[model samples]
Target: MRKEFLPFARPSIGEEEIAELIDTLKSGWITTGPKVERFTAEFAAYVGGRFAVPVSSATGGLHVALLALGIGPGDEVITTPMTFVATLNTIVHCGAVPVLVDIDRATLNIRAEEIEKKITPRTKAILPVHYVGQPADLDPILEIASRRGVAVLEDAAHAVGSEYRGKRIGCFPTTSVFSFHPNKNMTTGEGGMVVTSDEAVFEKASLLKFHGMDRESWKRFAKAGSPRYDVALPGFKYNMMDIQAALGLHQLRRLEGFLVERERLARRYDEALAGVAGLILPSRVPYPVRHAWHLYTPLVDIDRLTIGRDRFMAELKARNIGTGLHYTAAHEFSYYADRFGWRPEDFPEAHFVSERIVSLPLFPGLTDGDQDDAIEAIRDVLKAFRA
Candidate 1:
């Protein structure tokens, strides 16, 4: 067994990120200033989007995006049950009902085919997550959204550099939010960005990210900026600080390299664990896509393993190998279930995946030897549990 506990995920920060952070602190202006602007611009270019609005977090980005789209009490936002609670939480926060659809068994993403059946006249948007960095089947989702005149707001928290059908996930005119949480594909400490090509939505989202000010509230006190500002709408305080953006600016530059290392590690896991008894590895879609490999989650066959997912995690922990539950079915949560009367059977695939999924240690900084240690630990756990 490895002498030290292997964490499920860790941020890879180097001297460059530290230096940039220090530079931001020394610049005297820290909250949502030039570094934030530069990060937004670079992020916009990275995603091939016309505009980017950096925010406090992906959850904040989702809130602003829904508000920008004018989603309110009567609106219903369709999304998946396979994602983090924030995916559904933002819908409720925006005064909209969260309508969840089942996930595709292969990709663990919202089943695009099932979306049409669930769309009522109140359905104002389809909020699909690029689950675990695999792009959701967006072409059909976009087609449905276009025909229905509903918005498509992607919960791309795990998909920074992910692409679908030769096009980047966030490049579309519709709104897409990317997370910069410590455990995400890249780090901005704790930040998020909303990307879009639609000028109107961009403007609305930008305003919503601040205090609903017509112009950024941060600029109002600056010598060159106007002291007067207009509140176009009631909005949340979700703006990203320059301190966070300082890290993001450097992280964005190194994103490609981060992705490369992630892919290599993921392939290594696949090769090492392929056909392992009681394990089901993640699968890729046939479309031309570049998966960002945010989390290497695999499903355990409880019946074959003679123990459930919780026990498996405990066994791994005892062996000093940490694991993570990416999510339990969002709809099956007490709040959602009580409020929406959602049952486990409502979305069978999502419920099943939720029960079995476990995220292994997969980060840009994970060494080959670390991976071997993880595999060995897992094997030991399985064997001990079986015995």
Candidate 2:
């Protein structure tokens, strides 16, 4: 057994990130200011987006995107139940109904075919998440949305560098949100960005991001300017701070390299876990695009396993190896079940995958020896606990 504990994920912060953050602090402007603006512009270029708005988190981005799209009460947004609750919560925050479609068992993404079935006159948008950083089959989804005249608001929190076909994840005419959480493919010390090609949504989301403060504030509060400003609309205080953007600036610069390391580690996990009994590795997504490999999640085959997912996780921990549950079916949560009258059987694929999925330790900072130890621990646990 290894003599130390390993976390499921860890941020790969470097000297450059620390130096940039210090520079932001020393510049005497720590809130939303020039650094934040620069980060947004640079990120826009990185993803080939026409506009990018930095926010406090992906949840805030989603909330702003839905609001900017004019999704409100009586509107319905189609999404997946395999995603984090934030996706559903943001739809609810917009006062719109979140209509969930079951995931494709192969991809763990919202099934594009099932989407058209759920559309109604009230369906105003299709919110699909790139589950586990694998690009959802988006051409069909986009075509459906176009034909239906409904917007596509992608929850791309797990995918910053991911692409669909030849286009980047956030480069479409529709809006998409990317997370910069500490555990994400790259860290901004907690932040997110909204990318869009639609100028109208971009303008509205910016105005709604910071208490609806007009862009004139930057001019008004200048060295020689007036202090007058106007609030165009009621908005949330969800703007990203300079400190977060300072981290983001460097993170984005290093993201491509980080992704390279992430992919290498993910592939190593695939090879290491191959033919391991009672475990099913993540798929290599048959889609024609690059996977950011944000997570290396494998399903624990309970039918062939001796222990339940929870027990398996506990055993991994006792051996000083950590693991994570990417998600439990969102609809099966008590709040959603009670509020929407949802049941486990309502989405059989989501329910089954939720119970078996576990995110093993895979990060840029993870050494080959660390990963080897993790593999051994998993094998040991399976051998010792096998039915």
Candidate 3:
């Protein structure tokens, strides 16, 4: 048994990130400034996006995107219930109703075929989450959105480096949001970015992200600038700070390498757990898209296993191995159930997957020995449960 506990996820911070953060703090202009602008530009270029607006969180980015698109009261946004609560919460925050669709059991993403049936006059957009770094089937969703005149806003919180078909997740025709949370493929220490190819949406998001300031305060307060600015409309204070952007600048530079290491570890987990009974591993689509491998989640077969998901997780913890629950059915949550009148049967696949899913430890810095320890722990737990 391992002597120390392994966390389900850990951020890989290096000397460059530390030095850049220190430089930003020492520079005295730590709010949304040069570092933030540079990071946004570099991130935009990295993902082939026309514009990228850094925000406080993915939830904030989603809210700003909805605001930019004018999604409000009486508007309904179609999304999947298999995603994090923030995916649904942001729609409600934008004063729009969150209508859920079931997920494809194999990929754990929203069922693209069911989207058109959910479209109504009140339906304003399709919010597909690239669950666990795997890109959702987007071609059909885009086609449906185009024909129906509804927007497609991707909740790409788990898909920073993921690609759909040949293009990156954030490089699509419509708007998308990418998170930089500590557990994500890259870290900006609690930040996100909104990417868009639409000029009107870009302009609206830019204004909405910073207190609706017509001119950014950073530019106005700079050496060769005017001291005044105007507010076009009421907006939220969701801009990313320079302190966070300083870390993001270096993290983006190292992102590809980080992704490579994560993929390696994920493949190792797949190999080690390949024939493990009572476990269903994640699957990928047939297209030639790169998966970011944010979480190496596998579903436990409760009918075959003696212990349920909760007890299995506890056994792993007792053996110094960590695990995570990526999500439960968002629609089944108390608030959504009461407010949206959602029942468990509304999204059967999401509910089924949610009950059994467990995120194994998979990060850039995880080692083969660490993985061996995790596998051994799981094996021992299963043996004990079966005994």
**lDDT per residue, candidate 1, 1-387, as tens digits?**
788999989999888999999998998888988889988998988899988889999999999988888898979999999999998898998789989889987789888999999999999999999989999989999999999999999999999999998888789868999999999999998999999878888899988888788877567877888989899888789999999998998888899999999999999989988877777899998778999999999888776777899999988888788899999989889999999899999899998999999999999888999999999877776666662
Q: After superposition, how far is residue 243 of candidate 3 from its true place, in Å?
A: 0.7
Question: Would you list the C-alpha lDDT of every candidate in the order shown?
Answer: 0.90, 0.90, 0.91
Candidate 1 weakest ten by summed lDDT: 378-387
Query: TM-score per candidate, in order?
Result: 0.98, 0.98, 0.98
Q: Given candidate 1, what's the lDDT at residue 301?
A: 73
lDDT of 3: 0.91
Which pairs in model 3 have colliding backbones? none
Return model 3's CA RMSD, one decimal.
1.0
lDDT of 2 by residue, 31-104 (tens): 88888889999999989998888999999999999999989997999999999999999999888899999998
Pairs in clash, predicted candidate 2? none
